[model samples]
Target: MKKRYLVSALLLFSVLSLFIGVTDLTPLDLFSLTEDQAHILWVSRVPRLVSILIAGASISICGLIMQQLTRNKFVSPTTAGTMDSARLGVLVSLMIFTSASPLQKMSIAFLFALLGTFIFMKILDRIKFKDVIFVPLVGLMFGNIISSIATFFAYKNDLIQNMSSWMQGDFSMIMSGRYELMYISIPIMILAYVFANKFTIAGMGEDFSKSLGLNYKTVVNIGLVIVAFVTSSVVLTVGMIPFLGLIIPNIVSIYQGDHLKKNLPHTALLGALFVLFCDIIGRIVIFPYELSISLTVGVIGSGIFVYLLLRSKLGSKSNAS
Candidate 1:
């Protein structure tokens, strides 16, 4: 019941996004689009909408899988250092493959992202604490170490301006040619769907999964690969849109429980909706002048993060009492 309502709300917001941009595009403009109007609709509005939807859904679902595999609700690409590692790879590309194409940069970013996420999982293996909250803190510290290194190099090369642009998430520049790299996430999302059961079982812990004859390590490696690929693609193309991953999955799980298969679609839907809502708000908040999606999501997501923290604390107290 809740899922249906959320899905409906998402659809409504998506339609609203099409009509509410700075350009005076009405419902009539969509139907009887002149060549110039068609160009605006195709080159600007449609692609932007698609990018937001893909970016939102892919990151959220990736985060959901990460949390499940680690048995930690707080784990995500942003929290777990996967994104920072990928950014490091991007920085390396800028340093070494200075003239490389975006595709080439994406390849390096994917490699580093995989390496970073693998290292994070290894760190998880070493950690004695099984508390969900503590795990992401460790990941954040780990990510900060890599970020500091990236910042050092970026500053040295006078690439801080370029790097800063990449770090901040903005959807306003998403025209037709620029945003197509995000299509890579579609196949990766499909792969995640295909491996959904394996991920769910693997999340139960290595010993339990192995007892059931599942190759736990292999399943985990596969999940990590998907996460790295998706994170790199989104981050490289759209910049870092934080908390889409953390918030969407957590919300879905609240109503749908932790069953990966059941919650996956809802996570994707809510992610798209959340990003759309934020993007629309960013567009209209200052009218013609727009806020970046990252800033909008950051402010809103941080507030939600605080609320969730309080709710979790209260729930713990209630349970104890």
Candidate 2:
């Protein structure tokens, strides 16, 4: 997809997003905004829009780097246990920190997310049977184990209700002050762009990158750090937006090919557009009522995930034939 078209679509959807909530602000209101309307626009609508775009773009790019480094299409924070571990980290904060500030909680989550992702990478290295789908299937199981532990901890601590809030991805609660932590993803994403070529080189396998004078472990660790930071920030800020990372990168790779640097922007734009579309649908599907983002994205993203799996399988069969 062309950059211009993506930007145009993003701008259009962003405008529409500002107008879609419970309030009745419109483009015409730009000319004559009362104090109440302006307050709502800045404190609610604008922040929501900004956070949506940033969260979408950051998580999708994180997925791209993960897939590149692991050389697996099905691996992402969602699939690879990173998010679950981050959630567990939040639970740990509640149990230990008790009166932890948001920043403190996020710090704990970031560490757990990083540790979980590292373990997943270690599993990838140890297992020689990394089938196209098998790696992420393992990751899914690993995530389930972490989620179960988090759930158990929540039950023991009587924090199940609090933990459940972060389990569901929702933008309905995101306001100006609550979402600034996600800004951390901006610099991490820029670093991802800067390391794009090294990631590409690393994905070719350790020996190949080493032959080129690259320290494969260092580059891979950097990529994982970036992934962990972005994952933790988005989960902490927006809860869990399932499958935004997995499906967007695959869709972009089909038409755009696998050039990491080139595909980064398209992946980011497509992610924002998709999240905006889902948010709009969630808001309008039942009028004043709403579907959580987790539900909407899960349904649509899983459909696409299945399609990608089948398509890959069929392509393999045809090639064999």
Model 1, 292: alpha-carbon shift in Å? 0.8
List model 1 lDDT by residue over 1-321, tens digit each.
Answer: 477887899888888887877668888777688887788888988899999999999999999999999998888898999999988999999999999898899999999999999999999999997676789899999999999999999999988987887689999999999999999999899899999999999999999999999999999999999999999988889898887788778878888899998888889888988999999999999998999999999999989877777877788789989
Using all chains and alpha carbons, the TM-scores for the candidates as numbered come to 0.97, 0.98
Q: Candidate 2, residues 18-130: lDDT per residue as tens digits?
A: 98877788899989999999999999998989898998899899899999999998898899999998898988999999999988999999999999999999998999898
Clashing pairs in 1: none
lDDT by candidate, in order shown: 0.90, 0.92
Q: What's the lDDT for residue 95 in model 2? A: 96
Indicate the TM-score of model 1.
0.97
lDDT assessment of candidate 2: 0.92
The model with the greatest lDDT is: 2
